[model samples]
Target: MTLFGTTLDAEQIAALLSLLALLVFWLVVLRRERGYARWFKQWEADRKARREAEQAAEKRGASPDGRKGPWG
Candidate 1:
């Protein structure tokens, strides 16, 4: 049969559509995965930084009797 002034049977059209759908689906999934990974990495870094800061503060805070601890 004729499709868009060219020859393309129903099977050929179906195949082309399937390929396009698959390509688009995979591309979107991969892109999303990459975005998620990047976001997770940033979150991890921020969490680590905050944890380190808290630890440092705890170490630098006054002792039970209000005296500078070892890390002075």
Candidate 2:
């Protein structure tokens, strides 16, 4: 709150404010991810792609990356 020797030094006050800002930043990120925003949507798409790839590899008797597994 005070820049010069006000109970808490400038550095301590700045650190406290910075931590608060970081907390707000994480809260916003969590809200966006939970809301299925574009960023979260990208993750969903990636998961779907992995599922499809695994299914295809299974049919071909291989791993998800197209390499033959031990059973194959």
Candidate 3:
């Protein structure tokens, strides 16, 4: 087959296209996985902050839900 004036056998063309498609597929998958990892990291940080806040509130004799305790 003639592609961009370069002659390639049918099998070679098919192989090249298949490899190109595989490369694109892996790129997309890696992008999505990276995004997921970033999101998860943010989620984990938020969760940690919330836990710390709860612990601090507990030490202050206040309920973690922002309600006053019996003493207050």
lDDT of 2 by residue, 9-72 (tens): 7789889989999999999999878787877789999999999999887788745575564765
Off by over 4 Å in 2: 1-6, 37-72
The per-residue C-alpha lDDT of model 3 at residue 4 equals 93
How high is the CA lDDT of each candidate model? 0.91, 0.83, 0.92
Q: Each model's TM-score?
A: 0.75, 0.43, 0.76
| Each prediction's RMSD to truth | 4.6, 10.2, 5.8
Q: Count residue pairs with overlapping backbones in model 1.
A: 0
Residue 55 displacement (Å), model 3: 0.3
The regions of model 3 sitting more than 4 angstroms off are 2-6, 62-72
lDDT of 3 by residue, 1-72 (tens): 888999999899899999999999999999999999999999999999999999887779855676675755
Q: Rank the candidates by TM-score, best first.
A: 3, 1, 2
